[model samples]
Target: MYQVLARKYRPRNFNELVGQNHVSRALTSALERGRLHHAYLFTGTRGVGKTTIARILAKCLNCETGVTSTPCEVCATCKAVNEGRFIDLIEIDAASRTKVEDTRELLDNVPYAPTQGRFKVYLIDEVHMLSTHSFNALLKTLEEPPEHVKFLFATTDPQKLPITVISRCLQFTLRPLVVDEITEHLSNILNKEEIKADQDAIWQIAESAQGSLRDALSLTDQAIAYGQGAIQHQDVKDMLGLIDRTIIYDLILAIHQNQKARVSELLMQFRQQALDVSLVLDQLISTLHELALLQYLPELSLKYSAEINNKIMQLSQLISAQDLQLYYQVACKGRADLQLAVTQEQGFEMCVLRLLAFRPLQPNEILVSQTQVANQPIQPAQQPIAQQVQSIPQVDEVQAISPEPETVSAAVDHLDDEYYDDDPFNEPSAVQAIEDEQSSDDFLEQELESTVEPVQVVQAMVEATPVQPESNADQIVFDPSSDDALFGMDEELAATSPEQEAEKYNSDDFLFDEIAPLAEPALSEQTKIPVQEVKQPEVTESVATPPQDSLFDLSSVPAVDAVETSTVSTMPQEMIDTALMPQDILKLQPQVLEGVWTVDKWEFWFRNSELSPAVQELAQQGVMTGQINAESIFNIPKRYEALLTQLQHALEQALKSEWPNTHFQVNYAEVETTTPYTMQNERKAKAFQRASDLLHNEAAVKDLMQNFDGEIQNIQLK
Candidate 1:
């Protein structure tokens, strides 16, 4: 029967153990010095020579000729121990003998002297599986064992061992073999077995082992068998489910070039070959990481394989370092997400798609040419002035007018002498400064000019400009103070003016009264309005100033104003009261409110309670106050004020149609939490009483119970 390569080429001695020099040296020195501890713990990951070292230590301690670091295998003690027949040397698998009784029975014999060898050795493998009780029973004996008995413990999970047990034993940790070490070891094994293997094949096997010598040997064994005694790169690659490195490089290049079709073709090829999608992604991520490293640190770039090195160099040149980092992050995240994907192929495809989506487009030369062309102003066949105004919104018309200030000022100056020369406009001396301001203003106007229809801007501009009444334009407008005719006509006016004034007053009053009743009642006297009084000189006389019908052209006053007025009247009462009627109601039209509160803000406020809910709630809760000074009226906490401000703005937009020019500031007033003196005293007394009761019922009782667990049950406290 031909034995498998893993078993045939197993390390038989300390010198043969791979990748654990520190552990080997310590065990060897301990044997040579005759300073061996009774218990030794070998801890490491699988395939790192944990069990191999344990057996070697057993052989060293039990060698018949002498306890030598290099045990003579021909000796009776060495051969028996190696062949597992030595009476004094016992090897126990803790994984199997994990019961407390097993440990107790085994340790019961520990006190006896060795039957044949200098020291009796117990090799326990996978010792972490021992039960708590078993560890407890072994702990005492392990701490202080007889001189002739030796204990060697091996475990992959040292963390599971009781700290007490760990403390009692001497520990040696075996490190994983590096790729070079594993490759060299595989090479020597292949030579010993007379198997021909490529250096790259050996290296691939070594890397696939991930720093485990046993695993590396096992993989090499499989490769040799697969190749019928001679290992090659293709055989190893097939066995490990690895995609060809060249194909991987080509795939990465395709991704870098953003060749979506080529990338998809490669993925299909991989699928046809039944390649592990996750592993392929893993390798890709690893390759990208290596490339990123090369881009940053040229010195560390020497270790990769020739193909990988070449690919890294090419990638480093093709992609910017920042883009490379981004691709690396995307690949890494894709690798993680792949695990959760329904299928590895789907995950891999998604990762590829993500890379494609995020990859920056190469600068198109054609785009630059087109941009240059677009930059050259193409004059329209018709004049754009009328089209520009029509394109801009009425509100933005103000900003549009700002840019032409100098030109308008110049126009105004020309008009000043010809029309009204009392005020001469100053010209801005710096044309560049004017142009800079004009550019910014034009940018804003362009947005409006493109979005707004020309008719609206014209209509708005006409509406916004104040025009003198045509009748008053020719009349000598008397100063109100100089016009005594107005005062003498008061009695005559009362007879004629009562009905018109009453009707006008009733209309205005009815509009305000309609919304006021829906508002939250005014808060208590403590919450006062912070109103500042402005005293204006009284109009001493009434002048026949102007007629509405004669002012400019009454025909062009716009039906929009009536529509706006009706809209404002129809708004929700709460919104009208809170946002439209407070102050500046004349200026805040529905369109202005719409612009101020974008669609997002409107939706946000509509979902929340109507404006002034807090104040209303406070009034209902009986916490209202009427003191209106700034500190007293607006001292509410920032949290409440923010909530109120948001609500107020939303209300403004909602009710702008009803009250076009309303302005209100949300004021938060802080209220002091006052505790009554009687309540405070009562609380203090209760706290003291509770403390006294706790001392007597809990602390004192605990002390008494602690002192008397039945030893002094009859004793009574004074």
Candidate 2:
């Protein structure tokens, strides 16, 4: 009979044990110093050398070399213990002898002396399986064992052990083996066995072990047998049903580049090969992690072939840090949600599609572009001129109007004279000043011509001109009397006849409104217009005239009478009143009241309710079964029991604000009735089918199908 590799390659002593130097050192020191405790306990996960170390300790205690850490196996005591035939070293499986009677029976022989060795050793494996009563019965004896007796307890779960029992024993916790340690151990075992194995194959076995040396050895044995004496990388991959790393790298690169067709092709290949999508997703997630690490920490080293490492470096540079993190999170979430998908392949494909769909926007992909605004055709004059001006090309129109810089200044002067002089209400003196301002036009022309760009000339021309185009060009024009026409003078001043105004020119009572409006325009244009002062005629009454320095003194002139009728008001009085209405007093549209919560109205409420997405999912999968007292009971599928409590609380919180008087209870059971989610899906399906029929009946669709032999593979509703 042949022994398995895991048992055959088991360590025989402390020195031979791997990945547990701390435990071995402590036990060795205790034995050498003669400070060994009466009771010892070992704790760790399975296949991590808990029971193995216990057996070795028992051998060290009963060896013929007088309790040495390194036992001489040739001695009768060490050989019998190694062969499991030592009379003094007892090995008991606690799982099989967990009753109090068995524990008491075992303790009855504790006082007896050793039959063949200097000390009696008892090793109990899986000691946590013992009943509570059994532990109580053995605790007093274990705490006060005879000088010649030793108790060694080994358990995978130390948490189940009583604190008192654990306090009395010397506990040693073992650590799980890492990949490198397991790989090295497996390599040494294969070398001793004279088995030829590829490095990649050994690495695969070690990784599959997930930090357990025993599992690694067992996988190695399977690989050897599956490969028929020689372990190969391809054989290992086939046996483990793992996709090739290069394929995974290609898939990642395609997704990062948003190659939808390439991703679909890879998914098709995965389907044909029957590869495990869950494993593919795990590998993809691991690769994404490596990419992120390389981006943030370029100096860090990764465990991959040189070619694969180069690919990682290339991908790190190609993908942004944010996009890489997003891909990683999506992949991890997809792996978790694989069970919820209709199929594993579909889940994996959607995960890759999500990565492609959510890439960062490029420089040119701004949400709103100035080009679109500039290209918009201007609306008619019915629209505000200010709004129309925004869509007009800025520099193009200015440059187009005056290609030559020499005429730019003259064109500006001509525009000014035409705009202001053409108005029927202009003052004679101001128009005369415009005519006189041409003397300095040559100097302005020199400045405008020297400018390099037409845009600068346009800017200078705008600054030189005063009185911008009026926004209210459509309003009614006022009557004569320079001050009254330009400054909106009071009607009383405009109503006075010229003969009466001349008679009252020397009047003592001069209204400030009349004098102030005349002074403001002169004050604003004092430098631009040169006016000579004129003295008034002699009068008996004291006349109120403008100040001595006042430009274009107008007190000598009398007020003119009003024109009986002014230009018609372009805006009607009704329109003005409506425009000036206060916003606070405006009528508000009434909102529809909520209807009663009944079985027929459940779908309507669910669709329109303001609930969180998580709570909505819970509500969608449920139907209102009945109402008990003030509490409404709902039944969801039993499969959602895992999420019942959390979703239940969210549903209640969302409903309490709307239906505060009624309580909600969610129960998990077999759903026999139709759910709101099912009804919604059915309605969507019907709508889609109706749309498809309408589309197919159209003349264009029929012509397209007949002319090109095209088929409708899918219908999408926006």
Q: Considering every candidate listed, which one attains the maximal lDDT?
A: 2
lDDT string, candidate 1, 1-718, tens digits: 9877667776778888887889888888888898888898999888888888888888887787688899888988878876779898788988888899999999889888888989888989999999999999988888888888888899999999999999989998888889889888888878877889988888899899998887887888789789997999889998888878778778878876778899889988987888888888888888777777777787773444687667768876676666677778999999888879998889988998898877754422011223333333323424344554444434323322333434444443333232232322222331123233232223433333322223323434443444432221111111122223233233333444446544433452344333332222321122232111212234433211222333122121111222244554687854433323111222222322233433322223223435465433322211212221111122234456545554545544544444455443434544353212223344344434433332333322433454344122332111
Q: What clash count goes with each model?
A: 29, 0
TM-score of each: 0.54, 0.54
Candidate 2: where are CA atoms >4 Å away? Answer: 362-718
lDDT of 1 at 230: 91
Estimate, for each residue in 241-315, the C-alpha lDDT of model 2 and write its tens digit.
Answer: 988888988988887666789988988999899888888899999888888888789998766667867887888
lDDT of each: 0.61, 0.68
Candidate 1 residue spans exceeding 4 A from truth: 301-308, 363-718
Worst 10 residues of 1 by lDDT: 471-480
